[model samples]
Target: MILEVAVIFLAVLWVVTIAMFMGHTKRQRTLATQQVEADSLRDQRIRELARRLENYQGGTIRMGEELHELRATVAPLPDKITILEQRDPSTLSFAQAARLVTMGASVDELTQSCGLTQAEAQLMTKMHGNG
Candidate 1:
């Protein structure tokens, strides 16, 4: 009968529509979950990189300070040890005079700049230790 055919067709159409709606809802939920997970991962990576960058900056500052200290300890020493010795005709050898200059003016410059000897000038390295 024509009436029976129409009823069956309408029923089938209704079922199909319901099925399609459910499928679409499931896909939307899945997509939302995946988007949330991706956002969380991105945030975590950013925090990790920031921590590493801070550590690197701190290490650089410490290294610079240590280098400065080393230079200060060794650099300005020759000027401090200098003494103005007399230019006597018969004085110690050039090497010995050089040593006296190494001592922090232990022997005044006029009489004995080089009296200390080379070994003593080298020993002065201890006066200003690495610290």
Candidate 2:
């Protein structure tokens, strides 16, 4: 009778051990599946970010090229201004005299302010004056 009781106890212990092992294996499988899903989500996010970075880099390159082209287009403006600055002031005075004549300035005022002769002032006034 004692032997039979020992056998039954051993059988129960063996069954319990198997059940615990199966439960632990099931839990491990569930954890593995969750890990795989998390890894997949992380990879997808990385791909999306990489795509956005590529697009931004492409836009930056285009903008850089546009800036270079604009610089090239505007590069001659300063030289043109310098050439204009180096020209004779008398030419500028003549233009100023014409403008003054259009604004109804008298011949004496044009001669004093724009360094024009009285004859030249009269001619400019005749050509450009409102009156």
Clash pairs detected, candidate 1:
84-109, 85-109, 86-110, 96-114, 97-114
Off by over 4 Å in 2: 93-131
**Which runs in model 1 stand beyond 4 Å of their true positions?**
1-7, 68-113, 117-131
Tell how far residue 16 is off in model 1, in angstroms.
1.4
lDDT of each: 0.68, 0.87
lDDT of 1 by residue, 40-67 (tens): 9999999999999999999999999999
Where's the lowest-lDDT run of ten residues in candidate 2? 87-96
User: Candidate 2: RMSD over Cα atoms?
Assistant: 7.3
- lDDT per residue (tens digit) for residues 9-124 in model 2: 99999999999999999999999999999999999999999999999999999999999999999999999989978877765467777777777888788877776778887888
Q: How many angstroms is residue 45 displaced in model 2 relative to the true structure, after the best TM-score fit?
A: 0.7
